[model samples]
Target: MFHNSGKLLFFLGKADRLRITVWLFSLTVITIAVPLAFGNLYPTQAERDVMAQTLSNPALTAMVGPVNFETYTIGTMTAHEMVLLTALVVGLMNILFVNRHTRVEEEEGLLELVRSLPTGKGANMMAVFLHILFINLLLVLLISVGLGVLGIESMGWNGSMLYGMVLGGSGIFFAGITAISAQLADNARTSFGIAFAVLMIAYLVRAVGDVSAETLSWFSPLHLSSQAEVYGANHWWTILPLFGVGILLFAVAGYMASLRDLDAGLLRSRAGKTTASSFLGTPTGLALRLQRTGIISWGIAMLLLGASYGSILGDLETFFEGNEILQQMLAGESSASFTEQFLSLLIVVIALIATIPALMSMLKLYKEEKSHRVDLLYAHPLSRFQFFASHLSIAAVQGLVMFLLAFAGLWMAGVAVMTEPFSFLTIVGAGMAYYPALLVMVGVTVLLIGFFPEKSGWVWAYLLYAFIVLYFGGLFEFPEWMEYLSPFGYVPELPNEDMTWLPLILLSMVALVMVTIGFRGYKRRDLQG
Candidate 1:
């Protein structure tokens, strides 16, 4: 019975339930392609020599890893840069894959049905664990052969082999963490929170330790990825700790699951709301109630993150103090105002930060529709169009409030940096200029949810959207036509460029069109299964 149960789990995964496995291959190729393209872009000896000779600042080393400046070339940057990004992609895959197999399946009743049959306590989990192991193995071979084929075989085979082990270990460790979280939480939502809490802790420990040059990073999974500094001083033994902790967690999770009753979580959830929310009486009220907690949490966190980032502005010069080119690069024209440069960076960051709320707002459409909560709303007086618009209204307005809080946070921090309160409004205005772009993004998610209600969900669209903003717009400097494809691109480069209302109005119009079409589709279709 246990043997067939395990085999059934394997077959289910092979059936392409989420088409999630394909995402792994796609991500691996993209990771390889980014470095491969850059490596080819600068192949000249002198060009490589200049990069190899560039002095490493602590901030730069902390951001990218410690460079072997003498031997460091574009190839090294490619690998080092990928270390962090690759870890992020791999970690995301780990969490989502595990959660999908365990927690989300239980939430949706799939796990309960499977478990009713004769099976081992952690059959599904064993399948998930082994599935990820196979993926990680595939990744190791892919990246190693990929670099070797691309003619960038500059690192020791042993070091490169260790690099692959570290990458696989990183993902597997997070998967084990997710498995532990699945046992603790009663539902997928709580499980996600538990897992994400671990991720946040990992980053905070790693980032703070790196920023302060402390030993705290020794405890974080994120640190293990970049701490080796990849191309420089590759520690071959880091894989052992990651693998050991991950295996320990996996064993503990299986033991806990075996001890628990079927369909029951280790953490018991109790009914709440002895009294009712005032807004619980109406669909709009209920929607607001459902959304307000998320909005408030996001707003405050963004404000705090913005404040933290803003507080660090005056420190950038210190980071680049001895590097004249870097200083000039950041300061931009000794003649240009230093205050403006700092303000520009803050405003841009806060503006991009605002999109997160907008993305969450977009995602709510799926949560409500998929959960059949929207059906409850439709049972009332509201039309489908009205219902969809109501959700859209909350999202759009929430985006405005999110940016406002971000601006307020930046304003509060800017007073210390600007040494005057006058520039607060100036900075806020620049940040606010991003609203049109934010609105358009909100609309895109709404439109997708309205039409392709069953595809990959909001995460895929947001992933693509976010990558373009983070890399293409920020790092690659794409052309205007290409940049305009991103909702963020429609935004004026605040403080760096002057404001224009034409683009804003145009974007607003597009958003209006998207919302109209989205509602039309929602009104025509039945509620999701």
Candidate 2:
């Protein structure tokens, strides 16, 4: 039964011949190649010293998970950091892939055809598991090969094994999560929401525990990935727990899959208010309904991230005080107050966090159009201007909201330590200063939806572009013009530098032009079949 089922999934994934292969290959490269290259580049003693100091900061550890500084091996360090960040990329893949195969297949009205074949109740489960397993195994082998090529020797075979298992386990665990999520929701969107929220919660729990060590980390799979102790202890036993948990989750998911009706979840969705008030008649009103839930969710996430960053800010000075190289990298000049410089770096870090919501909001616009909901929206007397404006309003307002949530979190953390009263508002102002670039990002995404639908199909490209920009700016010494392409480039360096209005105004004008172009082009272009 499992064999036949696996064969079906293998064929189904081949539906997008060029696109799917490219997507997996790209993720494979990112999960493996960048670390290998970085390991080779930073082989010097001075480079290691700078990274050691950076990793010592509490927030860095919280964000990247634990490090094995003593081993001085880049691969081990990469494992620690990639375990957290790669899990994010992998988790999203699992959610999307599983939902595509299971819930989405049924939603498209293809389940009946498949059911007519000689298949059992567990075919779908077996199929999804096999597909995800293949992916995880392939990633493990590719990453191990990449690591070996980097020339950083691991301690015995344990280092390589631990690295592979931790990274691969992340995908396996999330596959199980998506399987359960698929069984719990009728639609792909709802299941994605549930699975993604769990992913966020996992990161948050691990972050909080990293800062406080309150034992809250044990509840999350994230803890398992990092507890492998890559080069430190190379704890072989931890992998068993992750494997055990993933298997149990899959079993439960299989049980639920068998119990649920085709294309249905455990909880039936009840119809809400049938009547639309006067506010719902306006374009903004409808936009609010469509975008409000996402805005609120991102706002809350930013606040939590801000709080996490703030929890470690007080210790950063201590972490970098002894290392002259780190001081130069962080503060730049001794003539200025180191404290002010450190706080400025903190603001830059938080601002980067705030950019995520901006990108997410922009991506939502593409989703709205791709799902074929925009046609219904435009059918109502709403002009193209209204339609475009509605989404732009959502993106701009939500970006601001997320910024404020981050500010609010930082403010609360500051108050707890009885820091200066004005410190919080200053950070908020600095954060708000980046709104123009964020809005431009939203506009860029909108334009992509209209003019380059095929390009927008690759969501991972957005992330990859960002990664390349970041790496080039800091690691490869790229020219300023190339870096300017990233929205983060236009943001004013906060805390340490004075604020400016010129850049913001210019960016706003650019965004307006982009939006105008997208709206006009989309209104005139032929709808895709």
Q: Candidate 2 — which residues are off by over 4 angstroms?
A: 1-7, 15-61, 66-76, 104-123, 154-157, 210-215, 323-349, 358-369, 374-380, 418-422, 458-460
| Candidate 2: 10-residue stretch with minimal lDDT | 325-334
Clashes of 1: 0
Prediction-by-prediction clash tally: 0, 0
Error of 2 at 335 (Å): 5.6
lDDT of 1 by residue, 1-529 (tens): 1345468557756754445556656666666666555555456657555543443444344444444434666556665667765776677778877887788777767777777777665677677777767767777777666555655656556556666677788888888899999998877767766786687678666766766765877778877776565656666666777778887888788788787775578988877789877767665666777676567767777787667656644444344433332333232444434445556655655666677667776677777777665677677788766666667778888889888888888777756754444366676788888788777777777677778777526545554655445343433433547655676666665666677889889988998898778767767777776
TM-score of each: 0.84, 0.84
Error of 2 at 169 (Å): 0.6
Candidate 2: tens digits of C-alpha lDDT, residues 1-529: 4436866776765764454566567666666655555555676666765666678566677788756546655656566666678767777776777777777777656665687787767886787777777777776776665555555565345576677677677778877887788888887667777888988889878877876784988888888777777766777787776666766778899898778788688878777688998988787787777666666777777887777666655644556655443354343643545555656566656666676666665665556666576778778777777766776777777778888888778767755643443376677887788777767766777677778865654534554565465443444445668757776577666666767778889999998898788777777876653
Q: Candidate 2 — what's its lDDT?
A: 0.69
CA shift of 497, model 2, Å: 3.0
